[model samples]
Target: MDLNSVYQRLNTGSKKWSQYPEDVLPMWVADMDFPVAPPIMQALKNRLEHPLLGYSVAQDTLRQTLVEHLARRYGWHVQPQDLVFLPGVEPGVNMALNTLAPPGSGVVVQTPNYSPLLSAPANWKLPRVDLPLQADANGEYPTDIAALQHALLSARTFLLSNPHNPMGKVFDREELQAIGDACVRHDVLIVSDEIHADILFDGRRHTPVASLSAEIADRSVTLMSASKAWNIAGMKTAFAIIQNADLRERFNAGRLGLVDSVNALGLEATHAAYSQGEAWLQQVNAYLQDNRDYLAHAIKNRFPGVRMHLPQSTYLAWLDCSALDIQHPQAFFLREAKVALSDGLEFGEDCGQFVRLNFGCPRPMLEEALARMERSLQPPA
Candidate 1:
């Protein structure tokens, strides 16, 4: 629960740490810098008591735990059998696209989305219809319903990222309801990614898109995981809730060889995360919110050229560096500041003036990154 404590992840085979040089600070990836919750570690340790590390299936208890969790946390009731386990959310996405959406059909995705979600449509040879999120006067990003409807007209599927990445905009219930109604009207399948559902700021609650109504649930494929919230991405486990029996069967069937079964330890860790990690989650959410506030303050006070709105859900910040007069913000920071961040171009072609910074690390680390970035902006002597 010590949010300020820093751990050495440089040589720990961490994807986030290993991606950048030893001297560079990595604030790019979505993974957190904190260690796993004690309960999660204990669950893994308990599972290791058994010597077999072979492939495994999700136990009935695990499924029931998830079922209870969905209902309790989001007020979304789902049957135990409605859940389909997968190695990760991306595969589930590809599975839904490959099986449900027809080839050459249009897939509607919001702009400035996660790189993988933005590119998944192309992997299936489907045309991607871009719908950009516009910010209001209050610096809040709201979905344009008319634009969404227009995009959905030709699109067969809508890939939704609730508690959206990069922007960290959590769609309100009204917005979600409107979107679901629109999709239902257009006969568009909904692939809702709620991976960041459990990570929210300002006491905001997460609402599952399918949970809006039973009719919406029928047409929706909700992909969720404990990875983002519980800091367990390396476990490689996630689940999809397909309420429609036919769709669920089709989605499970499409996992052709490329998508495999979940590992034993991941299943245990997931159950522990839901069953026992609530206290840990509460602590971490508070810490992340504070970190977000500090980062926003730093951007406003220290960096004149950088602009960022407070994120409502996730720890990632979409910083607009257009005022800084930098051609490529990501590359500039990486080379000049020795700070590696996710390039805005990866999110969308029009996002070249932006860079996504992950602030889920310890406070000192976040402060250090900001200091390095601030120093990089200084004029040469």
Candidate 2:
């Protein structure tokens, strides 16, 4: 699939490339620098041949494809009707919060989460309760169960990010079970973003929180997408699995005319990705893992002042630049290294000294970014 090949996205209205100047290397946004999978492109091309691009609905075939995908890949069996198509996961989250959660109720979210998940509660006038995930001695970010339970006391919804963003921590089955059980105990609805489910590294498996048991399924809204894994973010299609009929109905109601139906091309691309893009995905995963390892090694040996934990999933790396004495790492890299990265403050208020680097690019690009960063940190002559 030529995973290492870099395409020029400049002047193509790419969010990643257009965010910075021409000289700057953008490693900020979650989107990849690689081309879309051939299967997805072919599917889009085939759909275009019909000569009609009107408003569309997800076909039964697409639902069946998703159903088979969940069962085959994650061993998570779900009926076809359980799926609710959305334009994007962010809207699904806001919809769930706006309709399901009571007014002024608290929504529990882990700190240092994706910016949208961190802010969705506020969009619906719901209070946000922060449950911080701390990194232990091994540099692994583990959830604090007791804290989570305590936070749930004031909250009716838990916004979860599995194979989490920014930090890239993949929650194991035991951890998900504990979380679901706690939610069940407190009657807190789980709105989980499993968008990066297929992007795991090192033989890791993604477990949908609702997949743990029927009890969890009844209280969960699992949001997923083919965008992240297949490098088709522009398609803007994602789906939510709501096994509980009543909850699904309420979630659909929350769309409120603002959140519209998925586009025609997105549905076709999504079906193609799940049904025929596995081979392409496997190669991408391997390439990302190597890029991750290379980045970790470079940070350790080349930049002693910078620190980062190996991300278990996702192509994003959360780098701690606290030791570098930089007041704002993201801005520092952009100004000094001419490299644009996601600002840490967007993820969490206390994350100002941190920066998230997107490594889903060709090896040469990754190396070039590292080289620029290393040079930026050098002492003046």
Candidate 3:
């Protein structure tokens, strides 16, 4: 319940912490700073009691847990046989691109997306057609339907990020339905990354694009995990739901020995997360919502030069520093403010003036990072 309490993550092989110097506060990575859910921890410990850590496959229980989870939570009914477990979502994305999209074909993606999703097309020798999300009068970044239709003309696949990253814009049902209908009309394959599906804000329910209808499900591959929601990313477990039998077969074949089965402990943690971590998830969601509000308020009142919008989901805030006239905002913040944020250049070349701040840590850490950033902009003494 003590969401605001800070803990030491340094020297623990944490990518977030080790990315920068010891003095710099890391607000960059998607992984939360909170401890793993008690259920997950206990499950892992229980699994370790066996003392035989061999390469493992998911048991029936794990598959059923995911199937039930999809039905109960998202109203997406998928069979147990349709599940394919993988090491992580990145591998799943690459697998989908490699197998589903033909070489030399185009892959349509939304701009200002997660770095991996933006770059995955190039990994398979596929051309990437970027459709930029423009902010409308309501301050919501809506997908340009006309642009999407045009992009799908040449592209064979669409990589979607529901409850999007960096921007944290949750695609509403109408938008998703339109997107699904477009894909159907254009005969395009749909590869959706719904990893952040469970981390929504403002009473928003995550609707998987594949769940819109049977037609959409037939052409969709949904990648989801409990990593972000339950703080079990270290487990490196994720699964893909492919309803189409042929597509599922081709995707499983695309693993190419590079994408191996998940770890034993990771499987245990995942099962616990979906089955027994509901209370913990609710508590964390509330905590993250509060942190999101706190960060937004701080940015508005204390840092007038910086601009941000409240993200509908996820703990990341895309801070626009264009008004500040800072040439490289990420580097400037790291050097002057001693806070390490995700460089916007990674998301997109044109986003160099933007920085993604992760507020999934304790409240004190969030406050301290903001304070340091505010002080960095002060005139020299």
lDDT of 1 by residue, 130-211 (tens): 9999888988888999999999999999999998998999999999999999999999999999999999999899999999
Write down the TM-score of every candidate.
0.99, 0.99, 0.99
Worst 10 residues of 3 by lDDT: 1-10
> Between the candidate structures 1 and 3, which one is better when assessed by lDDT?
1
Q: Itemize residue pairs with steric clashes in candidate 1.
A: none
| Best candidate, lDDT | 2
- The best-first sequence of candidates by lDDT reads 2, 1, 3
Q: Residue 8 in candidate 3 has what lDDT?
A: 94
- How well is each residue in 58-104 modelled by candidate 2, as lDDT tens digits? 99999999999999999999999999999999999999999989899
Of 1 and 2, the candidate ranking higher by lDDT:
2
Relative to the unseen true structure, what is the C-alpha lDDT of residue 11 in candidate 1, on a scale of 0 to 100? 86
Error of 1 at 133 (Å): 0.5
| Candidate 1, superposed: residue stretches over 4 Å from native | none
lDDT score of residue 106 within candidate 2: 98
